[model samples]
Target: MTTTFYEEIGGSDTIRTIVDRFYEGVATDELLRPRDPEEDLGPAADRFALFLIQYWGGPTTYSDNRGHPRLRMRHAPFAVTPAAKERWLVHFRAGLDAADLTPEQDAQFWDYVTHAAQFMVNSLE
Candidate 1:
């Protein structure tokens, strides 16, 4: 049987850890902090972790709980400028760095996030 990229990277727990780390950065980042209005980051973290888990081929819990991942539409409320994308990538890069993955896996994950980040950009400002 062919293993998935999720399997290659260690599945749900790993994804959650990376997301937790990502949120840790987000919690402190001035640019990103105001984006999440919630005082507690747990809910946001859970949503993001589930999204990554499903996206990486682990499970469909995200869609099951939240319906389709209309990423752009969901983010439409936000400005999502170039600077925001860069800040987002920086935190995401930290998350990926904390994961126990091989170089290839890291690069693959990075590539996906970079593309996804660019796609999320809805404004030049």
Candidate 2:
């Protein structure tokens, strides 16, 4: 069976929908706090949305605008303890589950998230 990127999970709209929901959680998540106190999460949401689109075979907007995704480097300043990782996974899993992804797709997607979250772990103390 061939996997058309769109059909593999859903399509552009599904990506957009999931991203929007994920960012909504991030907006309120203490673990994934906004980098700027003076600004709300609107900008972060936009960036994350673009990145997800491109990552999930939708568009190249994120790379076009921001170049390569230096994810770990960008997050280096923040402290990603076990508690923060747990909190982040909670919100992320919630958003992903709410998207109604197929069981296989959900497992694949979650595996990526779990690994990514593990990779983002930069500190234990």
Candidate 1 global TM-score: 0.98
| Per-model TM values vs. the true structure | 0.98, 0.84
Clashing pairs in 2: none
lDDT of 1 by residue, 68-96 (tens): 99999999999999999999999999999
Would you list the C-alpha lDDT of every candidate in the order shown?
0.94, 0.76
Q: After superposition, how far is residue 34 of candidate 1 from its true place, in Å?
A: 0.3
- Residue 23, candidate 2: alpha-carbon lDDT: 67
* Candidate 2, number of clashes: 0
Q: Give lDDT for model 1.
A: 0.94
